[model samples]
Target: MEMNSSNLWVFIETNEKGQAHNVGLELLNPGHSLSRAQGDEVVAIVIGQHTEAAVASAEAYGSDRIIIVEGEEYARYSTDAFAYAFHALITKYAPTSILIGATDLGRDLAPRLACRLKTGLTADCTELDFDEESGNIAWTRPAFGGNLMARILCPNHRPQIGTVRPAVFKKPEQDTSHKAEIVREEIHFSIENIRTKLIEEILDADNETIDLEGAEIIVSGGRGVGGPDGFKVIQQLADALGGTVGASRVAVDSGWISSAHQVGQTGKTVRPRIYIACGISGAIQHLAAMSSSDTIIAINTDPEAPIFKIADYGIVGDLFKVIPEFIALIDEQILTMAV
Candidate 1:
């Protein structure tokens, strides 16, 4: 590895269906800015089986160069195989910087690859910037339990690596007209050397996965919701508006809702078109994750609630009463349209 390369590689992770993850495509949005500042090409690296679909998306999502490795062993994510294959590719390319999504597979694979390459790895970054003078990446992430933001730099290391949180940046507009240089590589690892094997996969029946990040409208509750039964009221409004249900850390901690629905510094970050905060007091950690929403509507009894400060519309009333009225209004509109 010469370490003089002028390319920024974004790892485009693929699922079993060979679909490119949104986080990878989203990272490309930032990749362009970073690469521009560094005066390097933005390259997309796709490793999966039958990756034609993923490759096409990478091209449409604004990758200057696409590197793909297709093999049967990559149909399902294996930490061993992915780490080994990625290690090989990094050695061959020697890219100046690599950005990976902080997904389950990426979290498992990044540190291992960093160890093998003997480089620094930054995890769960919420912001990214390049210092042209120092030729270093300034990775900004939450520190001290989301109370403070820390900017870290790895100056001496070559091929700076970082895993950024999903939805921290929006995906760029798709341009199918643009085409990128595609490079296909054949890299394989021994199946026998893999330490783990997929025996049986069990799905959680109690929890339904929510795409809160992709939702246009989200209705979230906090400690003010009272208890588990209060979420039922939140769900009714969410259902009426065709929105997704979200929760603050307090709600999740109180066992009022599953952790899958949590939104905050420790939980999933979302940027929906409209975010409604119900009975939430707006702690800094909660506000940090959702302040970027396009339109914020808050419903709380206390006029002094911090959430009211950032809300586009703040209703100082009991959510239990305000929500039902909102739902009834939506229902009436639907009935009138049907009539």
Candidate 2:
């Protein structure tokens, strides 16, 4: 492994509009920890046109250095162009490792750069640590149907790389007090070398309707809900509490709900203020996603359900019987508060 700079690099993912994604900032926390132990600086790489907001976010999130790659060709995400720029940077600096958010954009970019640089890339890592003894990163992720966790390593590779899932790690509180050295670099590659072109972008119609990632309270239903109609009860309880509805993989697989609402190892990861699991059996895959939630309430008929073990409060009852009562009690409480 030939090395030059020993700094850790984080890819700050941005949309075509140059809006910074939260996962990029979230990664800085682990990056800070790994860098501290590895005796290296944390570098945030902001790519695309008009990246001032991205740069500011990285600095506020505690990056020690900023590398900005801005070009007209980068205004849109053409894999060929972006990959070329990333490869150029890696060759120039030879950073010890690169961390990318496992976002849609990052999922696309990390592998391309890794292939170009001839290095290993781990995807969807839930945890990252610096092995003090081995002087390498231990990237931990769920494996084998989420029955077990696997910690992976790429000892022989320089610029070790991994893509971490969104919300797998908490976002560090922004400290505007922190600052970073800004390095502006130009992507000298020709746009003609790019094989792909961005023609039109059609945004998701349900983007405004769903926000499980930012939802404060989530009421999740699972296999015990019985059928599609079961979700209505879950929704009613969520509405009563001013929360959003979530679903287990079983519910989604049954075609009872949209995949957007699924929360587990295979779905979107979330850490909410309060999580209510109704009828959920709490598989390890499901627990891996929501275990970090501040408060968990499990309502199920089976006392032996795995969810009860981790729940802050467990209710042994049928969800159909329990939810309506909760809605009624909540409504009564609201009326009492108003009075």
Candidate 3:
């Protein structure tokens, strides 16, 4: 797998309906920047059936070109089929850098493709920048038990690959004026050749605790949340505000709450309209995930807590006192308005 161009490539993942996921389109901004720095093109590799809509989305979102791999075999994402399909495309084109969303499917496919290409892959990358000094991609992520940030580079590799968590970057503004080169590759892989068969997908009933990523307003608790009962306080505040509850890693690890509610570098990345932190000592990993929130309010007993630094509003007092008072005031206001 050798090539001449420094074209940056992105994997646009599509759902069952052939519509691209938000993360794939969100990654275009970073891809465009890297492409400009390298003086190359930004191309999106859209692999699925009836992916024309995804192709259009890629072009409008900033891709200079789009490669569509279409076949019945690709209708559903199978590891063997997608892996081989991506391997064929990359080996032929030899992109300078590749970005994949850190979804369940992508986590499986990215490493396999990187191994197939014999290239280094930076997983769960929070930042991506082109290093002019070394002429390589600089991938930054959390390391040392989420206590620090690490930047890695693969200068020797032809194509630098990275998996970025969903919602880590904001979506670029769409421009319908931009038209990308459409290159459709016919899939040659057969279903019989693949080992895994798609049974029916089991959809979980929508619950408040599980939809932290989609939550517009989140009231998250941290280490200060004493125990399992501590999360109940967090939940009450969330319920009062008509928002969802989120937890810090420490709280979740302590069995105070489920991992599904955790928010941070290792947990779900969220960019909600408003975020409220109660009794949480902010760690760098926690900030990395929720720093993008429009309005952040931190309520902790310690004035020196790291969470206060990024918070738009900081209340340095006992969360036990602050949250209960806060909820009562909110409820009172609602009742007053009803009258």
Candidate 4:
């Protein structure tokens, strides 16, 4: 396969419903910058059954070119099928760089594809930029248990591969006025070659559906919450405000909540419209994850808590009392609006 140094491919991972993941579109925001830096074109690769939705989204979001492969075997994600399809595409059109979302399925498929292509892959990249000197993609991620940051460069690799974290970058605004070149490749994977089988899909119980990344408002608690019982108040406030629950590393470590609710450099990074921190002292790692929120409200007993420094509105008091007052005010406002 001949390497094409003029193309940067963004892998758009789609679900069984053919809906493209947000991270794929989010990468396009950075992809355009990378392409501009090296004078390259951004190409979106979509592989799935009934890929009309994904293709339309890629086209709407802005891609210089779109390569699509549709087949029944791709309806549900299997490592073998996806890897085989991606391998075939990469072999046919060797791109300079490949960006994939660091999702559960993506984490499984990227290494396999990278190994087949015999290239280096950087995972959980928080930052990506084009290096002018080496002409390599600079992939940045937290290293050493989130204590430090590492910048990786695959200068020797033909097509640099990386898995970017979700919500690290915002999705670009839709530009229906722009159109991209669409290329549909007919590549079928034999049933025998696909070693994996999809078992019965079991949905997550009610507790596991915390969507902090897509949340408009997040109410978080930390060590000041005391214990699991303290989270009840936090949940009450979040429920009253119709928001999701978030926690610092300490709260997760203490078993007050699930790790899925944890927010920090080591956990998930979030940027919501409004973030309410209750009893949170705000460590640097925690702040780094959510400091980009549009509005931050911090409530703590200590006036000098670090969280107050960045909070848009700071309340130095006990969260237990403050939160109830907030719920009352919201309820009153809703009632007034109804009247």
**3 versus 4: better lDDT goes to:** 4
- Rank the candidate models, highest lDDT first: 1, 4, 2, 3
* C-alpha RMSD of each candidate structure in angstroms: 2.6, 2.8, 3.5, 3.1
* Residue 47 lDDT, candidate 1, scale 0-100: 95
Let me know the TM-score candidate 2 reaches against the reference structure: 0.91
What's each prediction's TM-score? 0.91, 0.91, 0.84, 0.87
**How well does candidate 1 score on lDDT at residue 237?**
93
lDDT of 1 by residue, 55-123 (tens): 999999999999898888888888898998888888888898999998888899899999998999998
Candidate 4 C-alpha lDDT tens digits along 25-70: 9999999999889988899999998999998999999998999998
Runs in model 2 with CA error above 4 Å? 1-4, 198-202, 335-339
lDDT of 1 at 230: 95
lDDT: worst 10-residue window of model 2: 199-208
Pairs that collide, model 3: none
Error in Å for residue 63 of model 1? 0.8
lDDT of candidate 3 over 126-168, digit per residue (tens): 8899899999989998777567889999989878999998887
- Residue 28 deviation, candidate 3, in Å? 0.1
lDDT of the structure predicted as candidate 4: 0.90
Question: What TM-score number comes out for model 3?
Answer: 0.84
